[model samples]
Target: MKKAKAADGKPFQGVQKLSVSLDFYGEKIDVGTLAWSKDERRAYFEYHPDFAEKRLNVSPFKLPVSEGAKAAPNSPFAGLHGMLNDSLPDGWGRLLLDRYLQKLGYDFRLLTPLDRLAYVGQVGMGALRYVPDNSLSKTDDAAIDLDWFAAQAEAVQGEVDEADVDRLLEIQGGSAGVRPKIMIGLNRKTGKFVADDGTDLPEGFDAWLVKFKSNVDPSEIGKEEYAYSLMAKAAGVDMPATKLIETKKGSYFAVQRFDRTESGSAHVQTVSGLLEADHRAPSIDYDTLLKVTRLLTRDERHVRQMFVRMVFNVLAHNRDDHAKNHAFLMAKDGVWHPTPAYDLTLSEGPGGEHNLAVDGEGKNPTKKHILKVAENASIPRAEAEQVFEQVQRAVDRWAEYAKEAGLSERRLQEIDRLLNKRGPTTAPDVDISPSP
Candidate 1:
């Protein structure tokens, strides 16, 4: 594809001016300039003149939003901040982008951020749609070979071949994560997963993302994530049902895609894209996220969901729960809600505080801090207390879930050490599960 245009009938620019519309459920909510200053130190987005709404500064980055923007920086490429960055596949997607560029006879180094956003098409997280079009298999939903995907991922990663990367992007063009992933639809009858490249399907299947873990990821990483999911559910966080896909090599962590429907289409929105925020840095605070949730959803229920997730991350010691990891989903009807949680793990983020803070407080966030936030957001004291209690219980049972998931002793101990180091004050209501 080519660059998506603004309402003024001009191609979108990167360095000078950024103008793109937010398309949700086929309606344009707002349009703004995704502009970056000459130094690239700051970026901003404002509403287009076509819309009757007031203009607001979204962010300071190139192509910060998903589809409806450009792929390369000067094009509709989604920037590498907040939500859009999370939606764009990192380690694997970057590799594929380079490969795709080489195949198109363009230098990967020369491709702009907007170029990348165009390529993301419909495969990005959340409900935002990009311009030009999304790449899907001719078949709507078909069975795919997970093992083959794994092998190809390894070949690309090991050899760093542009051809393989290009092929991979062509095969699975729209995903957001560090792992090499492909969208597949499983046949209920045949028990096979199908790769749908935006086309007709073999029948009895819809779209799903099959992720391959990198070598740096420990073997038990899948198991631990599964455990985390169970704990998150217990803590009242909305999480998609997760399963362990057992293969001869090992088990792969598989979460049902929140964006996809039974028809195999998707509706994903990251916190980054909704607020035009950045996910890579420490710019946004949890309070800002909470405020935005209320502003966008206008439902206290959604805010509560956000609160539960925050408590679960803090209590579970999953500090890697950055802005991107948390997201809101948009429906075909145009309503946005919090999507089922994924990417939960035992993580100690930058400097032992959350990648996204709790009301501007990071280290040593207390129950009092959480309650104060709840009160400010009009969350009832009883509900807020319930969230704290449930999460505390779930974190206290970590060892049981970890053991069931078969985490190695050393790895479990390492996570336990980090958990303990966070101090008892974080969750005075719960006791640390004994590590074996």
Candidate 2:
């Protein structure tokens, strides 16, 4: 069979200018235009006149609604605005795209950021859509085999020659994160899965993202993540629906796409994207997260929601809680709200410390540190304490959630011991370090 090209029938060349739009339901609203300047080696964006009149701040902090062409800071997002940068896939998705392009006799390094945005096209996580979309895919509504795709993912990671690069790229949907995953439209009633390529889905299907384990991951990572999702919800952290799809090959963790709704797609901006903060290293702290949540959503309830998530992460030992892991969703009216908590799992960040520190405490944040962060964020003491206790109680029942997830006793005990060891405590006064 002949392989598909990267951007429709067009050969993969670099993109100079791309049009941006917002896709709500099936309606497309022109947002802006992006132009790449070769001399400056950066991209400039100009908001559409109509969009500017609406004054819907797509990126309030970094790329707010403004007249004339605007250039983003160079350090964080490589000249592109943070909001647009969020649309490009990183980690696993980048790896797959690079490998696929290499097979087509193209040097991945030669492609500019605009070229990447072209590949992201309309299928990215948020409501943003790019045109002259160079994204590689064809319309084929065939049922998906998770087990087969899982094997292919493993093969690609292993750099085996027979891995189906085109198929993988078609299904990846330009998603972020390190785990090898695919975007699919699932029919719960019939237990059927189809490739979700940002197109209209068949009836009875909903968009979902499924994750397959990497070589270094534990055997039961899927079940453990499913358990964590349940635990997070129990602790009052807003979470999207999750499931553990078990196959003869292995169990894969799946979560329904919160960016997609029955009515249309919602705009999502990660803390990393909104602030241009890099997720690869420690940058912000819980206090910053809370403050941003309050500022963007203008809802104390959302601030409280962030606090609950912070408490859950600290107590559950999910240290990989980076900026990108948290996000805000925008309604059609341009109102922003905290997105449901995601990427909650057991992880040891850069140095066995939380990616986003708590009141300047990263290595060993305790109740004192949590409370200090709450105080800084202006959350009421009584309310913060209530939220902490609620998360604590849910985390205390690790064994129960683990059992429901069908985790091995040894694994369950290991996590239980870790949870107990990291349980909230009051530490002595120490010189607090500045947020990284």
Candidate 3:
């Protein structure tokens, strides 16, 4: 039997322009250019006359807020544009791309950012949809067993078989992060998984992203993440709907696609995309992130929400709060808002420091540092104190959360010690004014 063709039909050697659009309330809005040329080494983009009229900045920093052509400096974004690069998968997704390319007998070296976006097609997070779509998978509501998929993904990662390569790539499209994950159609009420046909979800199912254990992770990672989600919600941090899918192998953490619904999708631009900051290191600060939140969302509440996350990251020991992990979502109303917190778990960060500095202090970011960031963002110090107390209360219950997540005592204590050192017994209700 002939092997199924790779979803990406062909490689793009040096494509100039890619048609870009926004799926606004089920209608396509022609949003200007996604192009490259000989004169420009890095890919460039510009807003169409109509999109600029709406005043929705796709990227506020590198790309102009006004209507005109702009080329991104090719330092951080490789050869691809930063915004478009955000659409490409980083760690696991890149691995899947290589595997898929080899399976299709295509030269992986010829792979361009646009080509990767073609495979991402309409399946990528948020509203940007690519033309010449090639990521089409015909599925007849195939049974989806998380346990089976987990094993298959493991096999592909290990010294295993090549038979399940296509299935893996199809399900794992455009999933970012270090851990291997897949985008699936999930019916939360019914506890059913609908194999995504790569175009639309079957009725009654919402888009969900399910994660598996990477080689470096412990067995309880999913449980730990689920525990963090619960803690975040209790801490008054806005997070998307999350569930822990337990299988025979182990539990997996899954979060609802906040950017997707039945009628329309939200446009997403990561902080890295917005600022063209290299996500690989500590290129940006949380102070600037909060200010950006205020600038884009124009709401003190969103900035406050971000402040709450910064506190949680510190107290809960979630030091891997990198730029790419934070994002802003554009509603169909053309308003931008801070996305719900995800990717929250135990992380040592780079050099055991926070990925984003809290008031320029990364190695040891206490409540004092958290308040400093708020002051830098011009948030009233009192509100930051309230946020600090609230997140501290939630984090103070780490032992209870560990039990709730059913983590082993050894694993629980490991995290418990880390949090204890990071978080104090109680956050003082002192008037810690912002530093001058």
Candidate 4:
């Protein structure tokens, strides 16, 4: 392990280089090697000549089959490609790692991005594994309590350096996204959950990720997301089986891991990674997504599914639908398709506009914009309209969903107002305001 310094002059420990591998069943293949540039801001990866022919395009959009080492084309993503960056945790997971590093008497500030991937080891989601593993071991599990974990996660998000929860970094050590989530193995029959150890889960149990509330989130965010899950399912959008873990204080959203299987794991590729589009930049739109889905899956059903997700994201007030939020899965046979949707919730996007524009309209996309996307994807107008009606029907029931979700009346009204004002509303003469 080595240390790197941030531009701000803070020293943190991180890995300088790592060997990347892909697992197919019990077989391991040397995919490539990654190294950090002198400044630690840029990264370069080269495929092993021997594995070139058999190599899969883990990130087909940008990092395709190649011989020479290729550096990231731009610095929008810290000079690292989105696919590799996905291997590193962010938000809550980053905070956990930093805290754990601090507890170990190492300056987390010295942590480099590659070092972050090293910590991901072989336990991260998707099929990518970083070797020369520098991952931290389980320090202690006794201190990982629901209330304490929630408190610490909230404190970390609030930038309260004094408040830190012990052992949290171990339980939720390898997750991504802004929310505080823990990777737990659940007993399929008993609905029991146990801490995951970054290995093959024991028999009778499957891996599930549980998400807790962030400091900026509403207390009922869990229930709200669960309700959205239900709504998504109603609209024919693919959604993983979801449940709510209730504590005396609140409820937490839990979703089964779509990438994990009893025998092994599957490869995952996000829209942003596959296209090399930076999720933070909001450069790509839904039209691009549809085209990519068509080109990759070659299946109209998959294209239509992607269309449904776009509708749900728009009508449900889930403006935080950035590129990373959309993903696909690859089977061992090398086939790709849309994965079940996760991260469904009400959120305000950058400048309160949808990260993905619809038919050149990001501010106030209506039925016309959606129809245009479907038409462009070659999905029949009739089928697309059915999707719109189904999604709108479910969204119209937002009040009922909110009531069942136990959301406060104030939040319920606030969200309901936004939903009603959506440009996708089919009602005649309803002109929605522009994105705020």
TM-score of each: 0.73, 0.93, 0.89, 0.88
Better of 1 and 3 by lDDT: 3
Q: What is the C-alpha RMSD of each candidate to the true structure, in Å?
A: 8.0, 5.4, 6.3, 4.7
lDDT of 4 by residue, 34-153 (tens): 898865578898887877677466777788777799897556666677778777777777878787666556677665567788888887777788988876665434223566667777
Query: What would the per-residue lDDT of candidate 3 be over residues 238-323, giving only the tens digit for each residue?
Result: 99999888777779999998878778777888998888788888899888888889888989889888888989988887878888
Candidate number that wins on TM-score, 2 or 3: 2
- Choose 2 or 3, whichever is better by lDDT: 2
Clashes of 2: 0
lDDT of 2 by residue, 361-383 (tens): 89999999999998998888998
- Measured on C-alpha atoms, candidate 4 has an lDDT of 0.77
How large an RMSD does model 3 have? Answer: 6.3
Instruction: Rank all candidate structures by their TM-score, best first, as comma-separated numbers.
Output: 2, 3, 4, 1
Q: Give the TM-score of candidate 1.
A: 0.73
Top candidate on lDDT is 2
Error of 4 at 219 (Å): 2.0
Candidate 2 structure lDDT: 0.86
Q: lDDT of candidate 1 vs native?
A: 0.61
